[model samples]
Target chain A: MTVTVRPVTAADEAQWRARWEKYNIFYKRTVPENVTANTWKRFLDDKVPSYAAVAVDDSKPDGDNIIGFVTFLPHMFTGSIEDQVYLGDLYVDDEARNGGAGRKLIEYVYDWARQHDIYSVYWHTQHFNHRAQLLYTKVADKTDFVQYGKMIKK
Target chain B: MTVTVRPVTAADEAQWRARWEKYNIFYKRTVPENVTANTWKRFLDDKVPSYAAVAVDDSKPDGDNIIGFVTFLPHMFTGSIEDQVYLGDLYVDDEARNGGAGRKLIEYVYDWARQHDIYSVYWHTQHFNHRAQLLYTKVADKTDFVQYGKMIKK
Candidate 1:
């Protein structure tokens, strides 16, 4: 199966939502319907800096062969003149693992950033996500930074 | 000394720039002059989502008694209906250390997020930054996520 990456389209909403649900479940979290709707709308809103791209199995005749998706956004950074891209969410359907879809999706983001003149791209993953780290280690350097969070409004 | 936090203003540019330089140095990074100018402008730009709030020693007669500052921006998140704020850059002057300035700075961000109806606020710190971690632990939970990054463009 040949895996290819492309920007998400309006037609990919149903398939994207299905995988988005599974992505949240894999992390043991649930996003409410309203939030999911808003996120989806942001992806399509040209005015919004947020974006999404998907990896598909080109061999499949039907277009619903999305194997994974990546969501990212560019924001101003104190350390750079150009915007930095934050890879907020990334996930691959379990069945599509080890086929290079994950790496392809990441490279797609790199290309997108280069075309847009973005300076850097960064992401965070759970320490327990060793599998993704394997691919991450190959493509990016793991920073010494550890994350901290506070739920202001719960 | 009495400390208070408030949104950055046009008059705070010089003090803000001085502390911003130190903040970047604390992380062993160098931002170009152009980037520094742009970042400072964004802090005061109402059209930009990014914001900066400064902690000041109100007891000082001169308004330049800024102790530290925190910069943050809210963005769409898949797991929540409300925007999640990223505490991008935070720093407290070394001279003002141990006076609760850091905690006050963080709390200020919390209040800012609450006022904006944002749900969560998060940030990252280097593992060796134990001094800051002490205060961080008091105000926030250390998450399991580790950051990874790639410089697609220098």
Candidate 2:
């Protein structure tokens, strides 16, 4: 009857991968299977800071009900004294868009940050992702700095 | 007489601080002492992914001859098969700018990434920081994505 947001388990890899593939497609990107496999493995690795949270439908079976997911990692910043949680990805199944999965996934990350004593939780989206920006505006303040970077190798 | 780029040691904190302060001043940004201390501590802790590499004039005494520094951390990216080295901060003393200290410091990070089997190395600079861009162009390819993020809380 209710949507649940929680840490992902190994059993949800297939659903997580599907959502990941959809998310990448939204950006016109495709991740190699090896990269996807590694990302999923990191999500379960205790030694790695990588994590994934998913929103699921309680009315459906476990893996099939995962409608949305978010990934985040803790990072150190010289600008602040506390660690920052960098929200790397957030996406909800197209069919689950308006049902609050996106918002719940982000809030889940906020609580995670609070529990870890992380002072800031931040993330970025493409300039053209206006739909996501609409939701982003409601949940967090749009920060000041525009980021720039170069890729050194493949 | 030559510039030596290597991982920072505890003895280099003062010289590192001096260069770090100058770097912040260049961007009109100031990091509190506690944050600086935390960053320095992370650089030395093997458990943390954060790191600092410095370029120094070895012919001169140890710390005082330090001319530049670069900070980087290995991070997970959902799109990658492997972790990437995120180069967060890099600065060369104004007097030492043209002596290739900055380039040496970046190359040092590249070698570090190679050793760790990181798939890529990347970083960003302010839109107005043309000087750094000049060097970046020489060593890496300009990527297409624009970064955006919100600072939740601090």
Candidate 3:
């Protein structure tokens, strides 16, 4: 089955939300409805500078149901000494899995970054996300940098 | 040689800039003057929900000159569902090295976190920042979350 990717639009919100909920569940967590709604709103909010891309199947007649999505934001990198794109999230539906949709989504961002003269695209995923890592390994080298967080006790 | 820690004020701008310049030099970088001014302005800008703490040496009779500073922003963790403090930047002057100024800055932030009922306080430093790591290791447990980044090529 041939898959096509497109920029996410307001018309795709319901499908995107369904896929996002499933994606969060895979991580063994659930985001509140309001948070999800806010996230979707932010996607369409140009003033926020956030963007999202979605993958779809063209073989079907409708040719526009989103099967996967990727979200990212513009960030300044002190280490790189320049501005770059920061990929925040990427997820593909189980049915659309292993069909290069994820890779296409990344390449779409890569093309976007190239047009804008961005230095690089960077993101972090959980250690258990082996499948996503397999796809990521093909595109970029993993760095030794680590993420750490601690809760401030009230 | 007793040192006092306190909130940074507009009056401390000159001393703060000197210390910040030294700090940036150690990193082999120089931030724009306007950025430094903007940062100081943020401290007194009540509309901004950010704060900074400074380490001072009042025993010198200069009425407490700035030696070190720590800036933090309040954040809410989605997964753990807790309110925490994200320590953005912490810097101490080289002249103040080993003078307990750095430790005092952290201690003040720790106390501030506690009073606010913040569940935790956290920050990240490069692997090569041994001195900062040394101070960090004293107050919080190091975490295993890894950070990864990629350049989006044009």
Candidate 4:
């Protein structure tokens, strides 16, 4: 099947949420609806640099349906002399995996970065998620850095 | 020694740079001066959400010595429903370690987050850095996420 990627719009909300729910399930995470709503709102907000895009295949039964999504942002990070875009989230519907959609979504970010003259793009995953590593290694190089975070709200 | 953490300013450039360079060295990285200049500008930019705070110790030799700094911004992330503050850079002078400066810096971010109604603040550090982790563990719970990134520019 052929897949096309584009910036997510208000119309993509339901499809994006469905795919995002599945993505969270894979990580055993449960994100409350309020947060998701806020995130969607921010994606459409001008002051917030957060953005999202989706992959759709016209050949599928649900033609032009959003099958996957990638959310990203440009932020200051240490590895680059210039700011880099961090791919905060990337998810492809389970059945759609390995169908070129994943790579297309990432390349979409690359295109955006290039257009902005932003050179680096990155994200994080668990060490044991070899399945994701397979696709990730194909699209980008992995780093040796470890990740740590403190959740202040809880 | 008494210390105060406050928002960084144009006058803090020299001190901020000195410690930020040391910070890069601590992580075994080299950041070009241009990047640092750009980051400083971003912090001062009104439109960008990125911010910076510095810890000044009056008891030190310089009378009002800038000992360390923390840079943070509110961004969209997968783990939370509301926008969380990302503490992108946090550093303390080696001589000033274990004096509650790190905790104070973190608390400063918490204060900002609270005032802004933001729910979370997070950062990444090497797993091997147990000393920092000791303080971190005390302040916040450690997450199980591993970081992965690619330098697409190279």
> What DockQ results do all the predictions give, each relative to the true complex?
0.83, 0.41, 0.33, 0.48
Tell me the tens digit of each residue's lDDT in model 3 across B21-56. Answer: 776886677677666766677777878657887888
lDDT of 3 at B76: 39
For residues A76-153, could you state the per-residue lDDT of candidate 3 as single tens digits? 432333456767678898878899999899888888887777878877777666787888889877776545555454
lDDT of each: 0.90, 0.81, 0.72, 0.82
Candidate 2 chain A: 10-residue stretch with minimal lDDT: A143-152
* Local accuracy of candidate 1 as per-residue lDDT tens digits, B1-154: 8899989999888899899989888878888898888888888899998899999998885567898999998887767778889999888899999998888989988998899999999999998989989999999999999999999786
**A45 Cα displacement, candidate 4 (Å):** 5.6
Residue clash pairs of candidate 2: A124-B148
Q: Which runs of model 2 end up more than 4 angstroms from their true locations?
A: A1-3, A45-47, A57-63, A144-153, B27-30, B57-63
lDDT of 1 by residue, A103-136 (tens): 9999999999999889899999999989999999
Q: Is candidate 1 or candidate 2 better by TM-score?
A: 1
In angstroms, how far off is B16's CA in candidate 2? 0.9
- Judging by lDDT against the true structure, name the best candidate: 1
